[model samples]
Target: MQNDASTHPEGPAASDTPATPDAPVAAFPTTRAKGCPFDPPAELTRLREERPLTRLRYPDGHVGWLATGHAAVRAILGDVRFSSRYELAHVPFDTGFTGELPPAPTGDMTGIDAPEHTRYRRLLAGKFTVRRMRLLTERVEQITTEHLDAMERRGPVVDLMEAYARPIPALMICELLGVPYADQDMFQRHVATSMTLSSSEEERAAAMVAIDEYMRKLVMGKRTTPTDDLLGDLTTSDLTDDELTGIGGFLLGAGLDTTANMIAFGTFALLSNPDQLAALRAEPGLVDQAVEELMRYATIAQTGLRAALEDVEVEGRLIRKGESVALSMEAANRDPARFPDPDRLDLRRKATGHLGFGHGIHQCLGQQLARVEMRVAFPALLTRFPTLRLAAAPEDVPLREGMNIYGVHELPVTWGEAGGA
Candidate 1:
């Protein structure tokens, strides 16, 4: 199950520096040469076996270690040795890191250490509870059905990303935030452009500014005339106006792009794997397990960024404080130790601890909602379009390359007559 150096070639040197006392010692290859190697797990596996704690030369030429093994990645992600809080330090990865970092919504909820992150996350937890998410099931179904209906009316060849993937979650998020449906288009546009690798600095900056302005307005409206939505509930809480606006921006940005990408990517995985798709078609009850498998196979968030909080030894290497690290969940999900034949997609795969939603306290907050959306959307999609097939050749499909999130730019699909059941 493990790949040897003979099977997989050694990637480019991690950096010029030799192993230091309190830094990542081994040199690993940079994704700059290959443009985010997470797409092909073979490359990640090579790194895992050969250079588990090697340095990665980012596009900007900054050196950061890329952790490639299952145990190491999970240990580091859960361990306090590595810190997710990076607001104060001169982020090494930030330089030339083209991905736009939206202005901290909720002020510093994303990059702060415990106590602060704990408090903010606590306030937000009740909002995304399973009970709250269950209450949203009927609405989610309605939203999914509405989008599917629109797609059918549009015709045979439909861009699933535009017609289905984006709208379902976009509309759901809009309903949750209590924003008017008319404004969903504007919010969707800004968030989409901001996440693209092709977007210019000016374009990304504009998107953030536009989103911030919209969130500020929405926060004010909620304060004056509250509705029974997430925003209104937040206003009543002790969080400040700035914090409220921050939450709005965070919800819009995170909820829109991530879930949309998941929908598109998850659909691509299902369509490409005929056996798994067929099994789901035969036994519809396995949809939940199928969704979990999809999340593991299509780890949309390829790698997560964290900084070393203090000196710590992992797998016999000493990592110093302030050093940047990239945890490759894509590799972790495929680790043979965790799952048998990690590459193959299995509908019945017992995928309990997959890091697709992440691990530890900083794990994704909207995971419950995301799971519900996927659980409802996919089975319904297949059952509706029994003969659904990929519109483009698997090799020719245009995947969003070089971005942190792995997704298809567009998913073109065709279905037979009598589209929905």
Candidate 2:
């Protein structure tokens, strides 16, 4: 992959209007905006109706198209024209370090496209199959109970993020990866640092190196005494050591933050929408529908990075080959064309398909695991603490700024005693 810094694409000429620029013209915001791009802009509905494809200037001055309309966003994700392999391009954001990171000790499966992506994904498919996820349901429930139980002892007002949101997924992933329970702290620390969007380049690099080293050692140990864990399964398969490490890294990198954000953001959503919360509390069976709605509304993966494989015309705009583009899933989720009253959080909405988990061949492999986690976490949470409410003002809560994944930095919540329901 080429690392030519000068390859950054130039922005298009400015337009007259501030709110929505006309097609075939690039418009740069005067100052960088923090938080998720989907933070419900004051004029988003108007912008969607007027300008579906708007030019966005990245913090690094790299220019790309941001697709806002639901149909357009879905086309970009599902179309063969747009490619996820953009490590070679001088894009500002990191695409989950799928490539452009140091050579994977195990070759990276995320960097490769299908047949190869399909093959590697297939090997691990069984691990995340519905049956496997069903087996994990009890363990997940237990983990959820433990977190809530701990919160009860310490609570009144609790940082739900620290007390519940972070640990449940962290513990579940540790269990699934077969990493020793005692070593979870070490792994969690590494995963936390490695996944930080606010960290500097040096800090991120250091974290990645530390995680790689840890995985290498774990892979070496598994090679000799393989167990029934996911790591052990990969080790015993036809995968190379490097391949094994890559899979492990992929799981570590993908699993924790996304699910953590889901827990945090989902909690915030539930609290902010009391009616929805009460509805779920009244009918606990709505957990599945509620999770889907949260995924659609929250859309933690705010922007996906992709490069134009070849010069392609999309929605009447010409995209040059190799130019980087941000597939704004958040914008797509709220597009009125796909979802009527897209802004409202409706639990009964017929969510046929959403780009919350992405689309096409490169869709998320751990989606099943994510669904299971949410399915277990939400219902149990509502049932455990029926009176759960936000401890902080919604406007005052600090959100993760300028990160690929949209999540709150902290979610302070209050609930009744553990098992109070």
TM-score (C-alpha) between model 2 and the true structure: 0.85
Model 2 Cα lDDT, one tens digit per residue, 1-421:
1111223233543221222244422332212234333345434444567767666554445566666777777777777766555342434444333233332234455455566677888898888888888788888888889888988788678888888887877787877887766676676666666555656667766876887888888989999998888898788789888678877877866766789888898888878778888898999888888888888987887666556666677787766665655555777788888888888888878776888888877677788888888998898888888788877778667776555566787888876654442
| Candidate 1 local Cα displacement, residue 377, angstroms | 0.7
Candidate 1: tens digits of C-alpha lDDT, residues 46-75:
877675666665444445567877777888
TM-score of each: 0.86, 0.85
Reference-based lDDT, residue 79, model 1? 85
Q: What lDDT score belongs to each candidate, Candidate 1 first?
A: 0.72, 0.70
**lDDT (Cα, 0-100) at 369 in candidate 1:** 93
Scored against the true structure, residue 139 in model 1 reaches a CA lDDT of: 90
| Candidate 1 regions with alpha-carbon error over 4 angstroms | 1-41, 58-63, 87-108, 198-200, 417-421
